[model samples]
Target: MFIKLLLQVVYITVPILIYYALIRNNASLKRYHSILLGIICGISILLCMSFPISFETGYIMDLRTVPWMISFLYGNISTGIILTIIMLGYRIFLGGIGMFVVFIAYSITLLMILFYFKKYSQFSFQHKMKSVLTLTFINSLLIVSSIHFIFGFSESHYLLFYTVFTFMQLLLTWLTVYMIETFRENDRLQLEMQNSEKLYIVGQMAASVAHEIRNPMTVVSGFMQLLYQSDEIPLKHKEHVKIMTVELERAQAIINDYLTLAKPQADKMEKIDVKEQTSLISQTLSSYALMNGVDLHYHIKSDENFYTFGNPEKMQQVLVNMIKNAIEATLNKKAVTISLSKDNEYIYIDITDQGVGLSEDEIKKIGTPFYSTKEKGTGLGLSVSFSIIRAMNGQIMTTSDMGKGTTFTIKLPQY
Candidate 1:
C-alpha cells in the first residue's frame, strides 16, 4: 500500500514537473499557461484514477483531488469545471455506485472552491497552504464518510486504512502546493532579472552614445537659433528655421531622458516637503495645462506637511513628468487633479486625469523604453520618472478605466 501510494504521488507531480520544464524558457507559451495547466492536471487525474489504491472493502482511493483542487485554485473557473466534467465522465465509464458518491462529494468540494476562488489567488504562501490543506481535510473526511456509510465497511482494519489514506491525501496536497508556489516564485524572480538586464544594456548604450550625439545636435540647434533671428533671412526661410528649432528642442528633450537613464546620479538626499513641491510643479505647469485646455486642481487632505527623504530635484522631476502626462491625457475643458495625503509609513501623490483612459495591455507597458501611447512620444519620460522614484525608494502605481480616465499614484516612505 505504501509503495502504491508513493506511485500515486509521482503520478500527481510528474505532469507539473514536465509542464514547467517545457515553459521555463519559452515565453510565448506563457499565454496558454492556464489551459496547459488544466490539460496537465486532467492527465494526472486520468493516471491516478487508472491506478487507484484499492482496499479489500471494495473501496478505491486516489490523489485526484490534489490536481483537481490545484486546477481550481490556480487556474480559472472554466478550467476547474472542465476538469470536474472529465473526472465525472471517467468515473461513470468505470461503472460503480461509488461513481455517484464521487460526483456528490466533488460537487460539494467544487462549491467550496468556488466560494474561495477569487481571493485564493491573492493569498500569501502560508495562507494558501493552510487553505488548501484545510479544504483537503474536509474533502477527505467527506469521501471517507460517504464510502463507509454506503458500502457498509465495518472492519476495524478499514478504519486504520482510511486514517492512513486521509493522512497521505493531506501530505501529498501540501507537497504539490509547495512545489507549485516555489516554481511561481522562481519564475517571478527570473522575469525581474531579465528586465534588469535589459535596462542595464540600454543604460550602457545610452551612456556611450548620448553625449556624442548631443554635441552636434547642440551646435546645430545654436546655428538654427541664429538663422531664426537673422533679419537678412527670408521670412519663409526663418519660419522653416523656427520649425527646425522646435524639432531640435524636442530631440534634445529625448536625449535628456536617455541621459537620465544612462547616468543615474546619486543626488544629495534631503527631507523634501511633498506638498510644497507638488504645489510648485502645479504652478509651473499651469500655463502648459491652460494652453492644452485642461484645468489643474490641487487638494490637500491634511493640514500638516508631508515630508519624505529623497533628492528634492528628482522628486520634483517625477511629479512634473506624472502631472504633465496626466494633463496631456485629459481633453480640453477636462480637469486633472493632484491630491496629497499621508499615513504613518508613506506619503501618496495621486494625479488623476479626465480623458480617454488606457487599456489593460497599454497600462502594463507604461514604463517600457520606446513604448508610448502618444503618436510622437519617446516614452522615456515615464521611464526616467520611474527610475528616479525607484532610486528614492518609492513606488509608482497606475490605475485606469477605458473612456473614463487614469490615475498615477506615487508612494514615498515618510521621513
Candidate 2:
C-alpha cells in the first residue's frame, strides 16, 4: 500500500514538470494550457483509479482523489466540472457492489466543490488546505459507510482504507498548491527584466553615433538658421525657410537623445541651470516652430537653482528631439511645451506635444531602431534620445492617448 501511494504521487509531480517545461511559458500554446493541464490531471487520476490495490474481499482504495482535489484546489471551475463528469461516468462503467459507494462519495464532494468554485479559488493556501481536508474526510466517511452497508466490510478494513486515502490526498494537494504559485510569480519577474534590457541596448548604440552625427547637424542648423534669418531672403521663399530651419533644429534633437542612450559622454559634465539651457534651445528653434504653424513654449516651474549633473550639450539634444517630435505630433493643435522642475535627487523634464498620438503597441516599442508611425521615419530619434538619457544615469517615461497627445518625462539624477 505504501509503494502504491508513492507511485500514485508520481502522477501529480510528473504532469506538473511536463506542464511547466513545455506549456506554461510558450505564448502560442498558453491560452489553452490550463485546459490541457485539466486533461493531463484527468488521465493521471484515471490511471490510478483503475489499478487500485485490494484492501479486503469487499473493500478497495487508491490515491485518485488526490488529483481530483488538486484540480479544484487549483480552482479551474469549468475544467473541474468537466473532469467530474468524466470521473462519474467512469465509476458507473466499472459498476459493482462497492462502486456505488465510491460514486455517492465522489458526487457529493464534486457538487459542493462546483458550487463554491469561486470561493475556493479565492482561498489562501492555508484556507484551501483546511477546506480540502474537511471535504476529503467527508468523502472517505461516505465511501466507507456505503461499503459497510452494501458489501459488508468490517470496521478494521474501513479504518485502514479511510485513514490512508485521506492522508495521501491532503499531502499531495498542499504540495500542488504551493508549486503553481511559485511558477506564476517567476514568470512575472522575468517579463519585467526583459523590458529593462531593451533600454540598456539603446544606451549602447549611442556611443557609435557620437561626433559622427552631432557635428554635422550643428553646422548645418547654424548655417540654415543664419540664412533663414537674412533680410534679403525673398518673400516667396519664406515657407521653405520656416521648413528648413525647424527641421534642422529637430534633427539635432533626435541625434542628441540617441547619443545619451549609447552610454558615451565626452561633453563637459557639471551642475548646469535648467532654466538657462531651455532658454537658449528655445530661442534657436522658435522660428522653426513658427514655420510649421506651431508655437514653442518653455515652462520653467523650477527656480534658477534647479540644476542636474549632465553634459550641457547632451541635455539640449534630448530637449530638441522631444520638441521636434511634439511639432510633428501636433495635428490640429498649435503648441508644444517643455516644462522643467527639480528635487534633491533628480531633475524632471516634461515635453508635451499636441500631434498624432501612438497606439498601445507603438508605446511599448517607443525606443526601438527603425520602428516608426510616420511614413518616412527612420525611427532612430526617440530611441537614440532614450540611450542618451540612460547614459547620463537618467530615465525616460512616456504617456499618450490615441487622439490626445504624448508627454515624455526625462529624469536625471541630481548631481
Candidate 3:
C-alpha cells in the first residue's frame, strides 16, 4: 500500500514537473496550455483512483483531491470543471458506494473553491498555502465522516488508517503547492533578469553611439538651418532645408532620449511640491492638447500640499511625458484628465485618456525600449520617464480596458 501510494504521488508530481518544464519560459498560458493542464490533473486523478489504497470492500483512499484542488486554484474555471467531470466519471466507473459520497463531498468542495477562486491568484504565498491546507483538511474530514456513517469501521485499525490517510493528503497537498509556487517565483525572477540584461545592453550601446551620432546630426542640422535662411538659396530649396532641419531636430530629441537612458545625470534631490509641478505641466501642455483638439483637465483632490523628494526638473519631465501621451491617445473632442492626490505614504498622479485602450499583452510591453503603440513614436519617452521615476524611488502603474481607455498612475513616496 505504501509503495502504491508513493507511485500515486509520482503520478501527480511527474506531470507537474513535465508541464512546468515545457512552459518554463512562457510569460502567460495559452488556452491549449490550460486544457493541457486540465488533462494532466485529470490523468493524475485517474491514476490515483485506479491504484488507491484499499481498507475494505467499497472503501478506498487516494490523494485525488490534491490534483483537483490544484486544478481549480491554479488552472482556470473550465479546467476545474473538466477535472471534476473526469474525476466523478472515473469514480463511478470504479463501482463503489464511496462514489456517491465523493460526489456529494466534491460538489460542496467545488462550490467553496469557486467562491474563493477569483481572489486565490492574488493571495500571498503563505495565504495560498493556508488556503490549500484548509481546503484539503475539510475535504478529508468530509470523506472520513461520510465513510464512517455509510459503512462504519469494524475496528480501531480502520480508524488509524483514516488518520494516516488524512495526514498523507494534507502533506502531499502542501508539498505540491509549495513546489508550484517556488517554480512560479523562480520563473518571475528569471524573466526580470532577462529584461534587465536587455536594458543593460541597450544602455551600453546608447552610451557608445549617442554622442557620435549626435555630432554629425548637429552639424548637418546647423548647415540646414543656414541654408533655410540663406537669401542665395531658392525658396523651394529653402523649404526642403526647413524640412531637413525639422527631421534633424526630431533625431536630436531621440538621441537625447538615448542619453537619458544611457547616463542619467546626477541632480541634487530637493523636496518637490507635487501639486505645483503637476499644475505647471498641465499649463505647459494645455496649448499642445488644444492643437490636437483634446481637452486637458487637471484637478487637485486635496487641500493639503503633496510633496516628495526628487529632482524637480525630472519630475516635471516625467509628468510632461505621461500627460502628453494621454493627450495624444485621446481623440479630438475627448478629454484627458490629470488628478493629484496623496495617501499616507505616497502621492499619486493619475493621467487618464478617453482613447482606445491597450490589451494585456501590449500593456506588459510598455516602457520596453523601441516598443510603441503609435506610428512615428520612438518609444523612448516613456522609457525615460520610467527610469526617472525609478531613480526617485517611485513607480508607474497602468490600467486599461480594451474599448474604454487607459490610466497611468505614478506613485512617489511622500516627503
* Top-TM-score structure, candidate number: 3
Task: Give the alpha carbon lDDT tens digit for every residue of 1-415 in model 2.
Answer: 6666677778777887787787655765565665877877798879777877565454567767767876665637677777777887887788866667777788888887777654453344466667777777777677767767777756776677667666766677667766776775587457436644765676556666657887887788777777778888886686687898788777775665555445546567787677788778887888878878888888887555666777787778767777777887786437888888764456778888887677655776686666777787877776667656766787777767677788888877766
* Per-candidate alpha-carbon RMSD to the true structure: 6.9, 12.6, 6.7
What does the lDDT read for residue 334 in candidate 1? 91
Off by over 4 Å in 1: 25-28, 56-58, 119-123, 148-162, 208-256, 259-368, 372-415
lDDT assessment of candidate 3? 0.84
What TM-score would candidate 2 get against the native?
A: 0.46
CA error at residue 158 for candidate 2, angstroms: 2.5
Ranking by TM-score: 3, 1, 2
Off by over 4 Å in 2: 56-58, 73-75, 119-121, 192-415
User: For this target, which candidate reaches the highest lDDT against the unseen true structure?
Assistant: 1
What is the per-residue lDDT of model 3 for residues 1-415, given as tens digits with 9 covering 90 to 100?
A: 6687789789899999988877664646532567778888888888888888865444568888999888888888889998899788887887868887898789888999988655575455777888889999999888877778787876775678678888999999999999999988897567557756766777899999998998898789888888788899999998888888888888888888888887554467899999989999899999999999999999988999899998888888889889989999998899999998875667889899999999877887788788899998988999888878878887787878787899898988899
Q: Candidate 1 vs candidate 3: which has greater TM-score?
A: 3
- lDDT per residue for candidate 1 within 226-300, as digits (tens), equals 888888999999989999889889888888888888755555888899989999999999999999999999999
